[model samples]
Target: MAPNVLSIAGTDPSGGAGIQADLKAFSANGAYGMSVITALVAQTTTGVVRVQEVAPDFVTDQLVTLLDDVRVDAVKIGMLANAEIIRAVVEVLDRYSPRHVVLDPVMVAKSGDRLLAPEAVGALREQLLPRVDLITPNLPEAADLLGEPEITDVEQMPAQAERLSALGAKQVLLKGGHFDGGDSVDLLHGDGVSEFLGSERVETTNDHGTGCTLSAAIAALRPQRSGWPEAVREAKLYLTEALRASERLEVGRGHGPVHHFHTWW
Candidate 1:
């Protein structure tokens, strides 16, 4: 049977991110993808205007119903709008114990709109971070995880990645896209080692939903026999190529979506 990955995330009407992006990434990479929505985000390229969270019990029901029927090889967790949803998902993870879990600490949208609640940050750190197989955080999100206001230097990202691992993530992928430079480098810290993945920075304002895409790609690749490191590297390569192809595409007036089918058959 083919491998299967699950994405516990939100709904994006624009179809640019959340469960939609996760499923697309999985299918794009030849894996089956499933989802349990945590929230319904009213959003567009310009920004997020409002959010409606799914009830915690209903969220649990979705996970339970799916896990009961199929075996999940990996899971990608996205927006948990509140503490209740965080706890609810944690319970399911505790019970079913998916083989691979990717945690993307989605605190805010690229447009500077808050996505996760302030209080749920604590719940995420305390309850969810330790359980997942891998945690992916960009520079700003890394700072939030450590409760530090800023990561002044790109060199400091590795140390912060270690700190995040100590906080209970089996491994950490600390992305360096938010760094101040013309080059974008993403660091993957795992098993007491750090691997820096670099690519030429594509200068464009169409970087919305990057975190969601990256996390989803990682999850989609996670269930392959290649293991986590190779999975992440492949995902990063895909994202880089997509960004290169789409940077010039004028899809929207605001931050544009990635050209996913740039190499479509």
Candidate 2:
């Protein structure tokens, strides 16, 4: 049977990011996909217009009810909008103890809109980081979590990744996508070891949901793979291919989306 992967995230009515992209990535990677929405975002390939956060109690109810019936093999956590929702999620995670948890620290949108509340950063860094099996943070998100300036040099990534791991994340995948480079690089630090995962940078503006897709793909592949290293490696390869094929999609005018189903369509 395919592993059951659940995405706890916000909604992207545009079908390019958030819950939509997560489900697509999960299914494309051969996992059974499910979702529990955290926010309803008025967004498109161009930008986020407005956001309506779900109530914390309701979010908790959704988790509890779903976990009560479904055997969730893995979970991919995205945009939890505020501190209360973060705490609510932590409580349930501690209770059920899902086998695998991959957190994509979604702090900002591809269009430069803030997704996570500023006050909630402390809650996410101090409370939620320690609980997850893996954390995937892009350069800015990692800097935000550490209360430091965004890293500009690739050489600085290892140290920054180490600092993020010190915050209690079992594993940290520090993404270096923002920097100008021939190859997009990410550092995976865990268990006192670090490995650099790199792929030729695909030149495309249609990369709106790359982070969400990569982390969800990792969660989807984790159950079938041997360990974090294997899962991340395969996931990066998948994202690279998706990016390479993104131009085939004509979703919207701005930063579109990677072709999650490139294998088929």
Candidate 3:
């Protein structure tokens, strides 16, 4: 049977990022996908205009109901807007102890709109980080987590990844997309092993949901019993291909999304 994957995140009515992107990436990667929406985002590829966060107790109810009935293999966590939602998530994660937990730490949107509340950062770092198996944070997110203003190059990724791992994450994939360069290099650090996964950069504005897609793909494929390194590599390759194909898809006027089913058609 395919691994059952769950995405706990906000909703993207535009279908480019958040729970929509996660579910697409999960199904495209051969996992049975499920979702629990934490917020309803009214946005397009252009920008996020508004957000409606779900009640914290309701969030717990959804998690409890799902875990009680479904056989979940892995979880991809994203866009927990506030401390209440973060605490709700932390509670269930402690209760069920899901096998694989991939944390995306979605603080800001592709359009530069803030997704996570500034007040929630402490709760997220304190209560949630310790439970996750892997954290896939882009450079900006890493810098925020580490209290650094910026991370400018590939050279800083290893040290940053190590520091993030010390924060209780079992592993860290520090993405270097925000760094200006010809090649996009990502560092995977965990268990006294740090490896680099580099690929030629695909320049395209249609890369809105790349982070969500990569983390979700990792969650879907991790159930294959592959190591974190292998899962990260595969997910990168998948994202690269998706980005390469996404240029042909003109979904929105501004930043469009990568093709989640690039391999299929």
Task: Name the best candidate (by TM-score).
Answer: 2
Quote each prediction's TM-score: 0.96, 0.99, 0.98
Question: Where is model 3 more than 4 Å wrong at Cα?
Answer: none
Report the poorest 10 consecutive residues by lDDT, candidate 2. Answer: 177-186
- What are the Cα lDDT values of the candidates? 0.85, 0.95, 0.92
Which tens-of-lDDT digit does each residue in 1-265 have in candidate 1? 6688899998887777788778877887768888999999998888888999999999999999999999888899999999999999999999999888999999988789998998889999999999998999888888887899768777887888889998999989988887779888888888988998887788777776778888888888777757788998888887777777776567666888775555683
Residue 36 displacement (Å), model 2? 0.6
Which candidate, 1 or 3, has the higher TM-score?
3
Encode model 2's per-residue lDDT on 207-232: one tens digit a residue.
99999999999999999899999999
> Cα miss at 24, model 1 (Å)?
1.3
Q: Is candidate 1 or candidate 2 better by TM-score?
A: 2
CA RMSD per model (angstroms): 1.3, 0.6, 0.8
Candidate 3 local distance difference test against the native: 0.92
Point out where model 1 deviates above 4 Å. 247-250
The best-first sequence of candidates by lDDT reads 2, 3, 1
Error of 3 at 259 (Å): 0.5
Question: Least accurate stretch of 10 residues (summed lDDT) in model 1?
Answer: 256-265
